[model samples]
Target chain A: MPIKNNNNEIGDSELVDSARHGDTVAFGELIGRHSDKIYNRAFSIMRNREDALDISQEAWIKAWQRLSQFNGRSSFLTWINRITINLCLDCLRRNKRFNAESMDQIDEESGGVERQLPIETPNPTRRLERHELRERIDEALQQISHEHRTVLILHEFEGLEYKEIAEAMECSIGTVMSRLFYARRKMAVLLSGLRQEGY
Target chain B: MIDERKELKIQAYLDGELTIFGRYKVNRLLAHNAEARRLHAELNSIQELLHHNELDHPLPEDKESFRTRITHQLRVEGEGTSRVPNRIRPVLKWVAASAATALIIFAGVYSLMSPENSNQTPAHVLLGGESIEPEAANASFITFKSESAKLSVVWVDTKSSPVASPIN
Candidate 1:
């Protein structure tokens, strides 16, 4: 429980103070604490490990430069997560890898299978272990359209609420929900198949 | 009443967006409906898996390398303000010299035109121009006096009435 507390609670104010006074070590500590989460979010969007890593690092640099402006209205992780998400979104936009048309098309085309896929078949015993389940989820996440993957990651991975996801994604809550629904349905299908596949 | 109530509150409860009453309704429904229980369990498992997955993935290489690169970049930027390309330095120096020269010329012209120095004659006027008054002929005189030392002074007035009479 204490470990959980330590992991969840960052000494953000201390880091901010040190960083404000130009302590790179303190900034690095902050980076080390949040880097994994930031990298994962970036990876969630960019889908390329190198791109994710690059963007996440760039996001940290930007966050350090802008640390003075943080008002602590939200949690520090939330603030950093927002920056990472924005950087990833910019990278995605610049690469022209994701577009509304592609997302809409994915939803329209994939929605039927997405819905028909039984997310939870009554299981007397869960067939796939958690690790295998995770791999399936990762693969399924990759297969979904970028826009939907982003919403799902923000919601499920980052634990952001619908409103926060909408704000970060620069879309409406309705869009976030729709994307989440589609993404979850697709995930359930994919995950069920992984169970069937015995991987 | 229970079915209607559960239907009303399922999403909010599952999303952790519900108030106490809504949660109570969801709890009550979960007590009876196997489907709701299964769905909630699935959702919770999915959320947990996603959060755990974030921890599971290794830190990307770009992150480590980029941090090093960025820190080095910032240090270099801080220490080396003169890192401007060699090609541009000469051009900048030339521009700076030209600007200084232009400023000097401007200041010189401004000072010359200022009213504070209005009485100063233009250099061109002193070349060869004659005095405006007409010259008088035979208007030169010499005076000598012996006092402590013999002093002789020569005076000339061309425009005076030719010294109407000789000096006494």
Candidate 2:
């Protein structure tokens, strides 16, 4: 039977149900609804337009194939974004983006330089507009290592718990905590520095 | 100086990942220690900034185009799943085996054809009665080259029997 309901007028749950029954139009509607969020989530981590585009497409394809497996434990967007994040992580791993050592990894691992730096009491986001703050955050995320950046994105944006992040990142809870702490410290520094630079 | 462990505890507190006792301890620390309070405030500001202001980047391409690409990929991958295992696996395996065998044979032939290090002459040239070194009574060494392989060969023989056909 054809799904007679208007696709845009319907909720994601109804679309999901119809898509699960092999309705390509319903699945395409779900894609149309959530593709930007999925692509943004991928872009937030991958930081490359072409890579983000490929991973987002792959995520949707995988979502279509596994639509039957989506149990609706979470929101449909959340479920699909999880797939996008996983694909991003896998692509990062395949490309060895996470394995490359940098000063961020050294600071994170070897009794951090960030550890010795004093805390800035002034709020980094106090004087800035929301878009400015977001631009600063994106710039800072780009400067950090993939591990630190991934942990921050997972915690701050995805709203994943420490344990959930640990599972997704395939590391210990301690590692997640350490990465999060250092990532926050780095963000504090970057935001403060960017504020000082007036950028 | 706030230790690393204490700092992480403060972060965990800010993130609400701490248990009741941990929260209480962190609260006490924040109340007593000026530095910990500053750290907490800083972390909290950053957290709130991140949580509220994640830059919303819309899909750079049109949604319809992106959706069409994904749909095309799904169709391609769906066909691949049905066609790959039963039909393509044997063909892929055969192609792989043929490639491997060809590589090995080419490597062997190339190595054999390399003659930069060779010093001996061809056997046919030797047999053509070119001026040759006289053989010793007890042993003799004959040096030649292979026509097919373009490699030099050295043969050693004793008075009793031929010890080796090709030594080099």
Q: Interface Cα RMSD for all candidates?
A: 6.5, 3.7
Candidate 1 matches the true fold with a TM-score of: 0.60
lDDT for residue A79 in candidate 2, whole number 0-100: 94
Per-residue CA lDDT of model 1 for B27-72, tens digit only, reads 9878988877765665555555566664356675555564567666
Candidate 2 stretches with Cα past 4 Å from truth are A102-104, A123-127, A194-199, B76-168
Worst 10 residues of 2 chain B by lDDT: B117-126
* Candidate 1 structure quality by residue, lDDT tens digits, A36-145: 77777787777888888788778877876677778888877888888988898777777776675465555444344544444454242445576766676788887888
Error of 2 at A112 (Å): 1.6
Candidate 2 TM-score on chain B? 0.45
Candidate 1 docking band: incorrect
Tens-place lDDT per residue, model 2, B26-87, is 98999899889888988987787678678877788989988887767666766755334323
Q: Write the per-residue lDDT of candidate 2 for residues A94-160, one digit (tens) a residue.
A: 9876777544386565566888776754434446776876787788789877888889999988899
In model 2, the Cα lDDT at residue A13 comes to 92
